[model samples]
Target: MTVIRINAITVPADSGDELAHRFAARAGAVDGADGFEGFELLKPTDGRDQWLVVTRWRDDAAFQAWLDSPAFAHGHRSESERGGGEAQRPVSSHSEVWSYEIAGGSPA
Candidate 1:
C-alpha cells in the first residue's frame, strides 16, 4: 500500500520563507530514489507557523530504504556538516513526522 509521511515543521513567524527556500534549493533530490512517488511543500495560509512536507512512497520498505540511504543524510545535513565554514541556523523551531496510509479516499 502507498504510504505518506508528513513532516510538520514549525518555524518562527518570520522564517517561513527561509524554510521554503531551503527546500527549493534541494529540489528533486529524492526523485530517483527507489519507490519514491512524489512530494509537496505546503505553506500555512492561516497565520500558522507549521509547514508541511508531504511525501508519498510505494510502501513502508521503500520509505525506510530512502531514510537509510546516503542521499537522505546528505539532503538533511547542516551546512557545517557539509563542510561549510559555519552551521546555518535551522528555520524550524519544532517538527514532527506523521505517518499514514490510504485508509479511504477517492482516486486521484
Candidate 2:
C-alpha cells in the first residue's frame, strides 16, 4: 500500500516565515524524487507559529529510500545552516499510514 507521512512543527514566532520558505524550496527541489507521490505544507491562520508537512510515497521502502538519499540529507543540512531561531526546538509530531484514497487529480 502507499504510505503517507504527516509532520507538524511549531516554530518560534519570529522564525516561522523564513523556515517555511526554506522548507518550501527544499521540498520543491525534491518533488521528482523516486516514488514521491505528493507533498503539502500547511500554515494555520491562528496565532501559533505552526507548520505541517505532509508527504505521500509509493510505499515504506520508497519512503525509506528517500530518507536515505543525498537529496534529503542535503536539504536538512541546508535548513540547519540557516539557523532559524526555533527550528531546532519545534514541537513536532509524525504519523504514518499504509493506505489512503485520493478523491481526485489530473496529470500534471
Candidate 3:
C-alpha cells in the first residue's frame, strides 16, 4: 500500500521562507532512496507559522528506510554544521508527523 507522510513544522512568522530555502537547497537528496516516491514543501499564507514537508512512499517500510538512510544522517549533519534555520534561526520547535495509508483516491 502507498503511504503519505506529512512532517508539519512550525516556525516563527517571517521565518517560514528561510526554512523553505533550506529545504530547497537539499532537494533531491533522497531521490535515490529505495521506494522514494515524491516530495513537496508547503508554506502557509494565512498569517500562520506552519510549514509542511510532504513525502509519499511505496509503503511504511520505505519511509522508515528513508528515516534510517545515510542521506538522512547527512541532512542532519549539514543542518548542525551549517547553522541552518533549525539551528541559527529562532523558529519554533513544535512539529508533528502524520501518516496515512491510501485507501482510494483519484490520480493526479
Candidate 4:
C-alpha cells in the first residue's frame, strides 16, 4: 500500500517565503530515492502559519530506506554543516510529521 508522510512545518508569519525558498533550493533532492513516488509543498491559504511537505512512497520500508540513506542526511544538513559559512536561521519555529495511508479515494 502507498504510504504518505506529511511534514507540518510551523513558521512565523513573516518566514513563509524563506521556508519556500529553502525548499525550492533543494527541490528534486529526493527524486532519485528508491520507491519515491511523489512530493508536494503545500502553502496555507487561510490565517494559519503551518506549511506542509507531503511525500508519497511505495511503502514504509521505502520511506525508512530513504531516511536511513546518506542523501537524506545530506539534504537535511544545514548550510553551515555542509561547509557554507554561518548557519542560516531556521525558518520554521515548529514542525511535525503526520503519517497516513490511502484509506479511500476515487480512481484517478
**Top lDDT model:** 4
RMSD of 1: 1.5
Cα lDDT of model 1 by residue, 1-108, tens digit = 899999999989889888888888788899999999999999999988899999999999999999999999888876466776666888888999999998997889
- lDDT by residue for model 2 (1-108), tens: 557777667666676677677776676766878988888877867886667677888887888898889878767655555565434543233333334445567955
Question: Cα-based RMSD of the predictions, in order?
Answer: 1.5, 5.0, 2.9, 1.3
> 100 in model 4: Cα distance from truth in Å?
0.1
> Taking the tens digit of each residue's C-alpha lDDT, what string does model 3 give over 24-104?
777788889899889988888787777888889998899999898878877745455656544554465798999977888
- lDDT per residue (tens digit) for residues 30-68 in model 4: 999999999999999998999999999999999999999
Clashes of each: 0, 0, 0, 0
lDDT of 3 at 49: 75
What lDDT does candidate 2 reach at residue 94? 33
For each candidate, what is the lDDT?
A: 0.91, 0.69, 0.80, 0.92
Report the C-alpha displacement of residue 33, candidate 3, in angstroms: 0.7
Residue 97 of model 3: what lDDT? Answer: 96
| Backbone clashes, candidate 1 | 0
For model 3 the local lDDT of residue 16 reads 72
TM-score for all models, in order of appearance: 0.92, 0.66, 0.84, 0.93
User: How far does residue 21 in candidate 4 sit from its true spot (Å)?
Assistant: 0.4
Better of 3 and 4 by lDDT: 4
Off by over 4 Å in 3: 79-90
Model 1: residues >4 Å from true position, as ranges?
78-83
